[model samples]
Target chain A: MTNRSFEQVSALLDDAIADTREQAQQLDTLLSDNEAQQVWARYALYGRVLKGEAAAQAPADISAMVAARIRQEAPPSQVVQGRFGKHRMARWLRPAGSVAIAASVALVAVLTVQQSQPVAPEQSVEPAFATNPLGGRSPVSYNTVLQQNAPSEAERAQQLRLLQSYMLDHSQQLQLSLQAQQLNEQSEAAAPQKDDN
Target chain B: MNNLKQQHHKKMITNAWRSSITGLLLLCGFLSSSAISQPFQVTDSNQNQAVALYDEMARALRELNFEATLVRSSGTRLEPMTWLHGVYPDGTEVELIVMLNGPDMRILRIGDDTSYYEPHDEAYTIHSDVTFGLLPAAFYKNFSELQPHYQVVGGRGVRVSGRNTHFLRILSRDNDRYHYGLWIDVESKMLLKMQMMTPQGDILEQLQVTTFVERENVPIGMSDVRGIPRPPRLYEVRNLRPPQFNLQPQWLPAGFELLRAGHRRVADSGLPVDYYLFSDGLTEVSIYVGSQQQQGLPSLAMQGRESIVNSTQQNLAVTAVGKVPVTTLQRMVDSMRAVEPNATQP
Candidate 1:
């Protein structure tokens, strides 16, 4: 209806409006008019020429190239905030989802493989052997050279003292184990249903 | 006439097929229902029987006078030992444990005084009602003491030491600690074999009896041990008090309670350490929180049923050791958080 329609269509193409949805709809309505469409096409060509994007010699298949590009693109009217936002979200999530799945698969594979393999043998401490304490000599000789032996003799003695404490600590655990058994039984009786059942 | 006969035969075959299918479906329904009901009936009785058997085993160990030869195996090493238990006419209990391999080590307990005699170490005595042996600790303790942490379950009967034996497996409720399986002689109620397994079902240690003989008189060797001299003074554990630690564990397996807490000096480093002991009845773990001087020790190591997880937090080193699965120990150490002085509940 007014020359302002051509200027508004141009502004919509350049994304110059803050409210893009209203401007896009206005441009769609204007394009329906043949006269407005012709003016829009002429303005686009003129802008491209001014920007030096137009070819010096027109390409022979330029029309075919433009048609193919238009076919590849989504319809401008359909690509609004909601649909395009979802498309962008899906693109962003694809790699993150793939990485998470890959990590879980690797973890499962590793656990299954570990379960199938035989357990490795534990390292053996020095076996308690017969020694004459009355001889006034350190009779308990270790077969494996312990790391503590690397330090001075005082360190080795300290290590033995530490071993003594460890043994004492372990011996005390026997009492706790007995207590645990009783507690477990009481809990089991109070709740007749067990986990395995 | 032939056509009519063929039709009758076809009708009979179809009826037979339909009835058979219906019967099959009925059978499946009945089977599924019974299977669903079986656990309640079976497990209830099994629980009662297992509890009774555990009580019987404890009574057998206390009242019965028997001498048994046992072999304890851990990793590649094997240690054979002889266990002796007797009750005198004056109502005194005497038990002796003799190590038959590599060591001239022996344990002698008369009433409440249990003494340990090992090579190159002074014979020290500790006041205890039960003597330590290769069998599980569950055998010597009362059911009340152990019922809170481990579930006692009856397992299939098996032959052990050439005797008919019934199994009572002590399963940890949380599945984070070690599990123990014991085979008791059906007739005598004596423990025939004991096996300690990791959470993943790997055998870490086993003690199996080779010979069990009831003695009418006290063995001559045990009588000779009764005369050992003793002083009134004993090596006392000085840290008999509660813990003074800022760090408290935030996570623990089910039924695990704090048994002992104190501060003890490290014999190797002379660094003071806050110690806490936790137990789920059948398994125990010790946690030590000290200065960062202990960081040079192994971060993680597992041997037999015992594992160690050493970690540091906020310039403090936390080490946990016990006969538990590695993951269990790791969780205990990782859950430790430094608490504000007023917020500390333990």
Candidate 2:
């Protein structure tokens, strides 16, 4: 590509990377909110299914499911539609789409399974999802797995915060590397012409 | 095996003898040259004549009016240029126009005021010392003072620029500054060819008389050059406070002494800078002291024409610029200290 065209492409890529990072952060915040917990749970479930993990069985607590769904997806769907369906989907799908799809599938499967299962107390299912995956892990157990599991409300919040920071840092570094590569290519292309002189 | 051992022993003995002889010859050669060049008593009348001739040549330089084409050399680079008219006694209205051929088109003139005219920019003014080339003021002041330092001797005659020229060697007493050799015109006493030699006897600069005209030529005024504008008067004479040194240097190189000191405004800080000048008859050093800045101390060892500037910053930023070694300049800076207000003398 010509130098000017290359620069233009580089700038567009930079903008795309920045936009992706901003959307990821917003999704993380939306997932953490108590009102949007069920939608967030669906997204997390979808993320697990995409990574080939089994979907969580939905709780028999219909009242909680309906309340959580209304708080999470209803507002977002209205806003997304009010803006533009295709454009909103495109923005959300490009970066977080894999995790998002997995989270959705898991939540749908859980809800469908709940329709068939016997009713359980609201607190029992909440503890299963909210507590550390290895809550009953012994002291002799490897610390790596324990560290990885985002147990409790505080730990999950901290995990999301750390993830956002790591993603932002990585995205910034990638953008800088891409910019340097583009500059090097331009300089290399110009060098031959200068040598000919 | 015994035969090989004997052969090796013979070779070793031969090598040792050869090296010893070589070393002895080198020592003898050095001593012989040193003896030949030594300053001996001037008993012969011709030796006195050589000194007298040099004295006359120095005086003649201040009186004669002639046109010359000179070539100045520094290291591997050579700058050829021409100059026209005037001398010191005549209130010399000299015009030196140097055409810098290599790298860029630079035209320099030293007359009523030093000016540089380049094709890319308008003519700009310069200071006197920079414009007068590298000839020391001591040469114009007195020729006899240089006799003890430089051993002047006559050399073989040669014809240059279609005029008979007599050569003279101005050998140094020490290796501090470079040596000079000159070819003077037999009749007019005009300098034809001048050469500056390195300490190791390598020619650093050579200015030859490519063409010479000793005629009653009318002097050219500064206005004679068209398109070249007159340089504006930039220096404003200000009443400045004399520099006060809190500490004095215990030791300085021979012939060097403090000349002048004053406080002047520096460019970067726009603050009063304590400035001092020291000269060893020929070479001059300027020392400036001011308040410290946010930036780190500037590095030492920047080169000029036979000069080096060393700067160091502590509580104060001290800069010493002169034709001296970096170590010498550093020592000068280290010697500086703060003095009491009452002790300062204007």
Model 2 TM-score, 2 decimals: 0.44
TM-score of chain A of each: 0.27, 0.24
Off by over 4 Å in 1: A1-197, B1-42, B231-245, B267-269, B341-346
Model 1, TM vs. native: 0.57
lDDT of 2 by residue, B69-133 (tens): 55665544456655544544336444444443432223333333444433322233433322334
Among all candidates shown, the one with the greatest lDDT: 1
Docking class of 2: incorrect
Worst 10 residues of 2 chain A by lDDT: A90-99
